[model samples]
Target chain A: MSSSTKHSKWRYVLLGVTAWLAAFMIPQAAHAEYGDVVINNYADAAGIRPAVFPHWFHRIRFRCKVCHADLGFQFKAGGNKIDMAKIIDGKFCGACHNGEVAWSVENCAMCHSGVPGTPTHFHGSTVQSLIAPAYKPLEGK
Target chain B: MKNKIILTSALALVISGPAFSADGVSAEEVTASAATPEPVVVAQVAGANVFNRNLKKVKVKNAPPPEDGIHDPENEGTYVLQPPLEAYQGLPTSPYGNYVDWVKAIDEKKLQPRWDRIDSSEEAFVMDLDVLREVKASVPDVIFPHRQHTEWLACSNCHPAIFIPQKGANQINMSGILLGQKCGVCHGKVSFPITTKSCKKCHSQPKPEDWTPPLSEATLKNPWR
Candidate 1:
């Protein structure tokens, strides 16, 4: 093959590779895509139904920083040791569930709403990127 | 002929060096390419299709498209149609581009939901400052009090949409926050305004003397409600 012809062909191949890499790195977001976290840490053992955390509902109104960064929530399900005491102490769930900020955490079944036979609350398509364990809580806390 | 082969090999190495050195490409592919000649490297470049095929393992479960009625007619019968607008499309070109203006519009239009709290999540959160400090931030690291905001707002107020819910996902800085990106989303207008002069409000430490450690016998027994 001629030198310039060979070079141009390689250039086309390079361009194609670059285009493929870009698409692979950044996948399109699914419309109304969301994921759920089933927190079984202490809920089931405590005689309460395991709490199911929804991603889509919360994401629309508030930014993730409020809970994950400012509020200090771990990204993984059952990652944070959330308990009733902590909630009542005005920590974790308590921070908001207190009567002033949100509905008082008086009801046990609010988050533990997912008892057996109750259909889990589901919404939005599942986002592949978000389904991964993204929240890495600060270390040495 | 030997020099031509060497030149081709050199070019091949030059192209593939980055993918190998960065350790992002597969190790198996790297090892295979390393033992082969220039033409083999070219074939390996072609094999990037295989790499992409592996990445395609991320399955996007098809959900019904919104009934917005903007889908292309050609794909009406198919589920592969694109949304009306891409996510990264810029905000409306109106003067109300900033947070304050947008909030005003929301209030005027009664766009704000009466129930700010979502039906779920009884727990609030408190992210520690230690993580920020560890990054060698010049200023005292800011503390996020989740309950303070969660009372009024819902989770979608900020999340994977605005600030990714993951640590190290968003590049937050005072300058950007001041310009109304991160904390600036509300702090200035809706929430408390930030002052560059005063650092203690958000940066205050858990008073060493008054701090009751978690897992304390009393806390473990029944923390003060």
Candidate 2:
């Protein structure tokens, strides 16, 4: 083959190799898909239930800027330095949980009503009916 | 012509000498040259601050060790500022776009659940049929703490869906979770941050065999309550 033709062929080969290498080296950038905010931190440590913070429910009722921007919640779980004292003092959850806006702090059973892992007595009745109607004994018996 | 050919060969050898020659230069010289690169050698001899540029912006001046000998950053009251819990600002059409906005708007609606009012109750913690079925199908029941979670989160955190006021109505399943539904919602993301093979981390019980506690027991205990 002529030198010019050979050189052109070599150029094509080099271009192919370069393209393959670039494709192999570059990772596909994955975009974040919206979903739940799982909280695996301190759940077992704090003896609390596996905390699953579902984002879908709250979004329908409120806006993103409310809690995250205004209340100062960290995007990541365990990111917030939350303690009971801070909450009772009206920080974090306490800011709104002060009774007027949401459930009153006096209503301990609303959250702390049942044991961890054990269904709350208040809500248990409904769940029991759906899953195990046979498990329920006669009222007085 | 012969001389020209020889010269060309010699030039090529010199250009590619390092590739072919096992000992192109003295080992000691190579080692010394590598150890004393231009930047490091220049800084050492000048006695100038290496991180001067970074220090100026943050105002963090390095000082001699304290007499007490404690080098903890916490003691110096210079802890790293945590990233705020703001909604991710990346995607315009996030499945949780509205949800992220809702959490941000928590302070405005005044709908944030009180830490005290948070249902840390064992009852609330109880895994519903959907959650229990999913756990039992794959592994053991995940010992969840409802009240303890409430302390850390707002009611808007997992209301109306992962859980509903009406029990047994919420459709939580392994499929949905794996698809980022229900508990899987945050397990792999912002919460425990699920992994491909993190079964034991969640499903495993609190027994000693496979137990690994991340936080201190003191922190776990409900001191205030």
Point to the candidate with the largest TM-score: 1
lDDT by residue (tens digit), candidate 2, B1-225: 445645555565578667646666644454444444465343354465445644212111111111111111222221221111333233122122222333223324333432233332212222322233233242555655553344335556677535685645766665656545677645544333344345554565534455453565677796974
lDDT of 1 by residue, B64-95 (tens): 23321111122322233233133213323222
Which candidate achieves the best DockQ against the true structure? 1
| Per-residue accuracy of model 2 over A25-91 as CA lDDT, tens digit each | 6442211122323333444356653233334444433344357645877554447866657779988
The local lDDT score (0 to 100) that residue A105 gets in candidate 2 is: 57
User: How would you encode candidate 1's per-residue C-alpha lDDT over A42-113 as one tens digit per residue?
Assistant: 765666555645443344345455566657775444668888888899887787779875668765544554
Instruction: Give candidate 2's error at residue B173 in angstroms.
Output: 1.5
Error of 2 at B108 (Å): 31
